[model samples]
Target: MDEVLIVVGPDVVADAGLIEEIAGREFAALGVRGSVTHARDAAHAAELLRDGAVVIPGRSGEMRELIGRAAGAVVWVDVERVDGVEPGEGATHLHGRGLGGIAWGIRHAAHRMRHPGRRRIPYGPHRDQWGDLYTPADSAPVVALIHGGYWRSIWAADLMEALCADLLARGLAVWNLEYRRPDLHGWEATTADVAAGLAALGDAGKVAVVGHSAGAQLAFQAAADGARVTLAVSLAGVLDLVEGDRRWLSSGAVAAALGRRVPRGAQASHGRSPHADDETVRLYIAASPLLRLPLGVRQLVVQGSADDLDLVDFGRRYTQAARQAGDEVTYLEMPGDHFDVITPATPIWQATAEAIAGALA
Candidate 1:
């Protein structure tokens, strides 16, 4: 039987016992052996990296060195912050998820062991420009999933893992994408990466782009800009950048994402406010899905009734605009939160999956 190791950093304040308990449960369920150890320091952590799958909890620059040495998969769990140290290649990272992140990492490691066909395919040279590809034995329609953390680097392709698994189970190819974020990279790079990611799936049949939150905007922009997308699905997406910026959604996440710099004494005007700079306005117009109507592709806009009111508003308005612009759109607004649309077990996602299947048909 395969054995997995859970290494807890000495400085980490989380409950190691609880993590072990969780890891044990997960390993047993996956038919893998598991053990937990507390590392005294960086050297100790490195020493423990010689064997089966490894799950390291806590952020440590030293752990990055051990990534190449691990014989099996490496999963890093950062319980504290989103901007924690990156483990680079040969490692999967789960950040800002607290203790649960450890469990998730373990599960991910186990999944990698169980499913050898799952592959990480790179679309660009940069470390972030890649997608996790999951496919069935037969050829199927591709579903490219774009995750969202308001265009921040913290959230990544891992956000869509559950949905990827769900879609693959339903006999669809899954591409959980990761791209450069505007916060670390420039907004242009972010857009370019999205386009490139979609283009990488050229040979994959009947591509459907499903993006959540900020990713929804990217997905829509890709479709509008003439990516090879047959259907575009937006889940609680920030479709309208101008209004999202004006509303100061997520404490001004939209402006920050667009790299907006509002000059002093600049006044709000015509859906372009707070930052009326010409370049900023141009960016908003180009990036926003609401502004880019008649995307010329079938669209499925799913909004949660209990999500951020701004998002709900954007979804509804965008659907209306798309329909008026002569675009085929299917709008689904139901009782759910921002995340329910992505959770495979939820009714909203069931409805969404059905809609996507029908559209792809």
Candidate 2:
């Protein structure tokens, strides 16, 4: 029987259904039967590779190991950039570098069900960095938590803790903060909540804000707006604003929030950005970290090649701009997708924990 075998690493639940469907269709199109099986690890894949099996594109240590181990025996495929997809496809149907696409759906739902919307929480500050204090003045550093979404009415501050739950073990307090969205108020309302929370904390140096996705951009904007931040981080922030603002303006939520259609054109869109409190023509340049620096804060930005949103090339482009402006910025790129840096039990999480620890220490 003419057939093709599909090999995949056991760790990739996100790609399972797509891989199977693709294999079956390809098999039929080629007049052959296609079967998919999990390799358990690279060792089994090594055997398949030895038999001239074609390697499916996915990135895991085992997949990479098998490819390097059998470069000649197998044909490597970038199944992600699948041969054909039509123009004007919705963003959800496409694949992003790391976990951008999958993470988006999972996160969008998670954020909506979890975060809700803008609300204020009490907090406190420590020594060194200048921020408000909520808890009694002591040596304990505040743990700043951030959430991710497209930054619209569809999501709020939910699920920020799951991927970043471990900062507590390192002697820091965590802050699960929120920002404005299409359903909420404007950017001013969101940042104002942040500003109020930080002020409540008391010591800016004792606080660290760890933010994800759209939350990252909000964090930087918050720090820049005189919030007295000690340390800040952005996890797959749509900081560049080029793509994000476009996407936001495209969404129905933006109109609902603004009470009008999102005016197109770069100048018009920038003017209507949720980053502001009102539809004022001013502060467009001052608001974006990419356009201007939110000075006096130490920052870290981590991205991955597999996740398109955090790709070093763009997405979070504001970090570099912030760095050039002489703000202390550290950039980290790793394997996996957008949420990869924040996912459970990885060096990314460990390193992030340590950075926050040191910043407060």
Candidate 3:
């Protein structure tokens, strides 16, 4: 019987049945009777690799070890990317990178749901126009937390509640900000919320903005739009909107956020004063933080080595631009996946905390 063994790390075991079906269909299309098999660990995977088995792509250390033992002949067979192979509920189909992002989103949501914030403050009349503030015993600089889910409506700022609590425990006042997702009020509403939150927080002590993914984009724009920010930390930020559109990052996330495809170097004027208390949506493609340079504020760009290659590249481009434009910018790269930058328990977050302290100091 003709068979092509499939090797995957521990995470894939839960969905082994779905993967088997996808693999079988793909192999059959290639004129072979493929039987799916899951290796228990890196050692088992190495044995399969030596026998010409196909290894599924994953960011797990075991998977990396197995790939290293393959002696450079490892074949990557991504059944998830196969056409007509739909990922299960709460799963992202089509690309392993997408899967990783979706998994993190789900985990964040679950974490947030389990742990509520200390207090909720409303910045606007809209239901989503509120911020959860986590206060320490003694007041400290306000660090605004923006969560990112490709700017989609399905994600909310609550996903960062865990991080907010951690920051508060560490002696920092946190405003876990939530703005309407682009699908609801468009990108303008998202930026408007950022502006409103910053304005409402007022100029009290050091105001540092820490945003993840899409939130990073808004934080930078808010700072440029006059947020009185002393420091801004973009964790896995989408710095270059034009480049993101070209690469189709997060599957057309930029286009969705902007409501259209914007060409590079297109100028735009959007949004209102961050101190304004009114509700108005204004979106401009030219407002991309990558183009708004020399922000005159200390900045930190944290890029994960295991994140999407496109994001890593975006961080590099942004760092270069900031440096050339004479902005005080520190680009730090850590070992982890795209979501690790937001996970407060990881060493990456330790590095992030240090960067925050350095920027404020």
The predicted structure with the larger TM-score, 1 or 3, is 1
Per-model TM values vs. the true structure? 0.85, 0.54, 0.65
Q: What does the lDDT come to for candidate 1?
A: 0.81
lDDT of 2 by residue, 1-361 (tens): 3234555565655567776665555555434544677777777776665232444435676565454452332334433533222212111112322333333323332222333332334342311112211232244777667566654533434345454335544545566664444344565555566666556656545677767766776677778777676787877665654434445533533234334443344452334455445443244444445654646788888776677642455544666567667888888766767767676566666676677678778
Top-down TM-score ranking: 1, 3, 2
Counted clashes in each candidate structure:
0, 34, 0
What does candidate 3's lDDT look like per residue over 299-339, in tens digits?
99999999999999989988998899899998989898877
Cα deviation at 290, candidate 2, in Å, is: 0.8
lDDT for each candidate structure: 0.81, 0.53, 0.68
The TM-score, computed over Cα atoms with residue i paired to residue i, of candidate 3 is: 0.65
Regions more than 4 Å wrong, model 3 = 1-117, 264-285
The CA lDDT at 125 in model 2 is: 35
Error of 2 at 10 (Å): 35
Best by TM-score: 1
When 2 and 3 are scored with TM-score, the better candidate is 3
Worst 10-residue lDDT window for candidate 1 reads 262-271
Clashing pairs in 3: none
lDDT (Cα, tens digit) per residue for candidate 1, span 1-361: 4667788776777766787788888777657788888988878887676434455645465654555453445777777665635564566767776676776677667666656688899999988999989989988999999999899776777777778878898889998899999988989999999999999998776999999999999999999899988899999999988778878999999889888843444343333455555666656667888777879999999999999999999999888888998999999999999989988888999999988877776
State which candidate has the highest lDDT.
Answer: 1
